[model samples]
Target: MNLTTTTRQRWAWAFYDWANSAFITTVMVAFFPIFFRKYWANGLPSEDITLHLGTANALASVSIMLLAPFLGTVADQGGIKKPMMAAFVTLGVCATLGLTLVGESQWQWAMFAFVLAVVGFLGANIFYDSLLVDVAEEKDFNRVSALGYALGYLGGGLLFAVCVLLTLKPEWFGLVDKTAAVRWAFGITAAWWALFSIPLWLWVRERAPAQAVRPSLPVLLRQSVGQLRDTFRHIRQLRVVWLFLLAYWFYIDGVDTVILMSVDYGKALGFADDSLITALLITQFIAFPAALVFGWVGNQWGAKRGILAGLAGYVLITIMASRMENAQEFYLLAGSVGLVQGGVQALSRSLYASLIPAEQAAEFFGFYNMLGKFAAVLGPLLVGWVGVLTGSPRLGLLAVLLLFGLGAWLLWKVPRD
Candidate 1:
């Protein structure tokens, strides 16, 4: 691709982040927990609801962890990354839009929809991430990754602001009730995802051409299995990459679980949905500029150093969050999270991209995603188990510091690109 074409394609790819982030912000992070607790689990005990949600999340993570690598391998070999991503995105968007039909009496349906959407969103990211190699030169990977994250923060933040406004003032939008307004917000997320996904489909041409790799289904399966085996066998040669993946797996778990579970944790401490939503909105906005700043810092210092600084901040925030006593503290925690979350994640992706081969990017990223999903199971389960056992979220929150510290140690050994 020429410079102009590459720039346009990169922006188109990044815009997908802008597009789908609304679902992540409005549906996954901000509103879904509130909807679950308030509307779904009306008669059930809070503990039971927490257990069920935790179990469902764990199950989804395990399922995705198992499937991601296989799908990534096939997509890479079959040259179907773009098509697979589109399918997953469509599936996720439809499932998100389906949230509109969920009602107080239909909590099960709502949870099911949420899980389906999560699966689609996460599964699609495997291929979406693999596209990085197609769009940018090695030197530009970090900046481009940062730009995508920055765009995601801004896009998600903008929609979150709108959703919060609509939620706070449903009557202003002529909605009959707050619940209906929230449902409308979900509908808007779906529409936004679908509409924004169009630019990538229209402009970012797929680089991998489909060729007839003739084999029966069984043969193809055997080949994929053999390739997986070979990849694992060769993993020793990729020791640095493996170490980075291991560190990323654990720390990102802490980051993702915190983002997903913070709202629930806040509610358990008596903060209302409005407060959590407002705090998340702050995170979204703060993360936009912070991502860019982190990108510059990564360029100036190094991705590893940038990630280390972010991890240090995470350790402090997680500890403080464990002891938080008021909504103000929650807002402070959210601000701290915004400052580091995108930077850590963006630099991690860029760092890995620099280490891996372009042709194997999808497969490696699939393994990366798998480890991430596998890690997702740990922090939440530990949190739920500890909270139930100890009757305090503080102990659970405190345990996350171990992950950060361990990740930092592992990261220290990863040689900088």
Candidate 2:
């Protein structure tokens, strides 16, 4: 019943990032693209696979965005951020584990499970993001956020490396085959995610206004709707935050699209799956320190400047991606992505945390996350559309340049805090 040390609480809070990221790096970013296309959709056209994945991504984002505001509002009203986070984390872990049960012929079930895991991972993040205010001192926010992301890169990258070895050399792991290794990767990811989540659940306090009375479902529904409307109005009134949201929406679209599609892009170019996996590994490993440095940069130069720098780097990275030819060049692109990916995301989180009122952290983070979820949906669809239309993923990647441009331009309008 004793409280954990502040340092312990901070580390524990950040460990959640370390925990759930295995699913992201291993499943979503690396193996899943290959698994879905080559395994689940083996007989289907590549275009069909692209369309289905895009649709699934959009649907998951939509569902999460719709509920994020209400969830945030209720968690704030009831002081239940910790418990809600726990529930979502559990959902994510279970869904990931479910993926292990899906056979290669069961693309439908695979997609269903994948969606549930994404929902759980991203949904849990709504509350987890809010907790930044609770766990970090004002001055340390950037560093803490950066460290979370840095460790996330390290932790996710380490597990993914193991998965890579298991898949590439199954006999070394005593697995029957690569397919079995892949299935076991799903279970390993789930277990890793679940195990690392324990610290924050036990140590981090949920700081929210206590609910005076528990409401009926109807009453809760009405309150949530009203809260959403009020939030919409309130957001429009905050010019800097509004402008930042607009900017973030655009640039982050490019970022999310790139992360989601990079492996698929390589596959389209006929790069071997092993090469793509190794390239992704390069990004994850290199990003660990790069993320921490960005945090330090934010601390010294301010988060705004740090984020803008990252955006500029991404603009270059996106343009370069379209020109990538073979595996070596792909590895170069992956490493470039590593240098900015974690830093940009971490800086953005801290920067937004600085702008919002701490008292309404969860509620406001809800709106923030909704905008983010909406952004996630936009990027992939645009990529898919461009790919389908031009018959080239290179052209599809070219489409993301505009997103970064608009995001940077809008971001410039927001004054530094």
Candidate 3:
């Protein structure tokens, strides 16, 4: 590829972050829980709604957790990462669009669509993340990885701001009410996701596998299964890789849980929907710059130290969350979260990329995303069940401290690159 083409490929690859983050910010982190509570699952007890939302998140994550590694092997063998990503993006877009059709008090159908959307969103990430190596050299990992996340925060936040406006001033958009505006927001988000994703499909190209002749489907499946077995053994033999994965599994659980549940938790504490949405917007915009700053931090101080610093911030954030009262306090916490959220995530990806064999990036990232999804499974459930059992969302939020503390301890043990 020529210089222009290479540059386009790298930018196109990063733009996928801009594409998918709309769903994560506008729907998953902001609107879904609010809509689920007020509209879809109306008349249900608060705790019951929290449990149901948690179940949906856990179910979606479990599905991806089980399939990520296997699918990674198949994609690596077939050299079909882009094709697989297209399939999942289609799934996610359609499912998100489907949400607009779910009428009032149809929480079951809403849950169904939400689960499938989550699956599509996460399933696509396995391929998306693996492409990082294809787009940039190892020396550029921190900078390029952080660039993608920065775009994500900006892109996701911009759309979310529009959505918030739609909800707050439905008359300005010619909508019937706030609910209609929210439904329209869902449809718009789907379109944004589909539209922004086209650049990646057209510009970025995956490196072909070594095999010249393409294997038949049956042969590919057999090879994939065998490769997966070998990959498992490879992970076991790679001490730093496995150790880092263990640490990622723990800390990212807390991160994912907070992102997924913060709006709901705020609502549970009696904050208004407007306040919650504003807080999310705060995080997104703040994280946009913070992610870039952390990229520099990773390059200068090392990814390990950058990640460890982020984890310490998270520990403090979690403790503050447990004691938060009023919207002002919630906003403070949201700003705090933004400062470290993208830094931790971007550094983690770059850090892991440095540790792993780039030849089998997809296969190893499978395990990376697998552990991520699995950690997600534990987090929402922990918060949900703890709330259900203790009848205090505060206590459930505090339980996340354990994950951050343990993860930080383990990460400290990993040798610096």
Q: List per-prediction Cα lDDT, in the order shown.
A: 0.85, 0.87, 0.94
Candidate 1 residue pairs in clash (backbone atoms < 3 Å): none
Which is the leading candidate under TM-score?
Answer: 3
- Candidate 1 TM-score, true structure as reference: 0.96
lDDT score of model 1? 0.85
| TM-scores, each model vs. reference | 0.96, 0.96, 0.99
Cα lDDT tens digits for candidate 2, 1-417 = 233577888899999889988989998988888899988878987877887788778888998889898898877766778888889999989999998888876899889999999999989999999999998878999999999999899999999999988898999888999899999898999999999999998888766465577677677667767876887788899998888888888888788888888888888888998889989999999999999999999999999888889888998888887888789988998999999999889998999898887877888889888888898898888888889998988888888888889888988889884
| Top-lDDT structure, candidate number | 3
- CA RMSD, predictions in order: 1.7, 1.9, 0.9
lDDT of 1 at 373: 90
Assess candidate 2 and give its lDDT: 0.87
Candidates, ranked, TM-score: 3, 2, 1
